[model samples]
Target: MGLLFSKFSSYLFPNIECRTLMLGLDGAGKTTILYKLKLNETVNTIPTIGFNVETVTFHKLTLTVWDVGGQERIRPLWKYYFPNTTTLVFVVDSSDIERFSDAKEELFSLLGEPELANAQLLVFANKQDMPNAKNPAELTEILDLGSIKNREWFICGTNAHTGQGLYEGLMWVKKQMKA
Candidate 1:
């Protein structure tokens, strides 16, 4: 009877919703990661001109991820969706050494905003499968993750093509949210 009651109770209550905002420069595998999590498979994607919202259920939580366009012109519009983001998932093309500064600039600018002050940061050092990709440790230094003081931040090495290290990143987000 106890087990039956517990199962019924779960159905009576709704899963907690977590709003995750995914951002990055073009070709950083943001869209690919989104689809991989949502469908459990890799999919070809073009540059996101606007944004895409998808609900992905992880364990008992429902994560609503917003994949926004990462082009220069669309970056200004990102602030508009900053109101209630629970976590900021920033994807970085770790192999693109030349764009590290550009990525850092955009990342810090968003973090400085008051609207995102309370949001937890999950930086995916994406494209880790590439030969010249920067590891998470190197990215932490290059992106200055150590200097962020307002909220908790983590950098994870991930290869979206094989779905490697993606779950670990989400697991971190879940743990933080639960805390």
Candidate 2:
């Protein structure tokens, strides 16, 4: 599909590409976000088999989001697309404390890559509707991203089921593409 799109777009636009990747722990609502972009509704997001792609066109720039699977077994595949990404959406399940470590490890490994040397990360601290959810400040600390240079982060609370913060998050991604 990527090859077909590449061929099609090259003949059409000739020169256009995306600037982002969305990845995080499983159940972080990344797929939900993808659905919001494509269908305006993510009814059932079966665990992404490997990765998924969605495009958002705004202000003359095409933002292609590579929604990578967050499962431990699938994360190694993320590096394959790192070279083209300029920004990242690191979604987290704020109510799931047991998984924060996994999220942090992935974030650290991603930041270490030269491909993502200057990526801007938007951490969606999701599940804010749940009583046990963690807030943005806690997410910043738990994700352990204090040392990453030249990266900006926004902590948003989202109930993926209700689509709260979904559009705002994409708009933020749109903003970064403009910058």
Tell me, by TM-score, which candidate is best.
1
lDDT of 2 by residue, 41-63 (tens): 75787888788887865444567
The clash tally of candidate 1 reads: 0
Clashes by residue pair, model 2: none
Give the deviation of candidate 1 from the true structure as CA RMSD.
2.0
Model 2, position 160: C-alpha lDDT score: 80
In angstroms, how far off is 60's CA in candidate 2? 5.5
- What is the lDDT of every predicted structure here? 0.93, 0.78
lDDT of 1 by residue, 76-171 (tens): 999998999999999999999999999999999999999999999999999999989999999999999999988999999998979898999998
Q: What's the distance in Å from true for residue 154, model 1? A: 0.8
* Candidate 2's TM-score: 0.81
lDDT for model 2 comes to 0.78
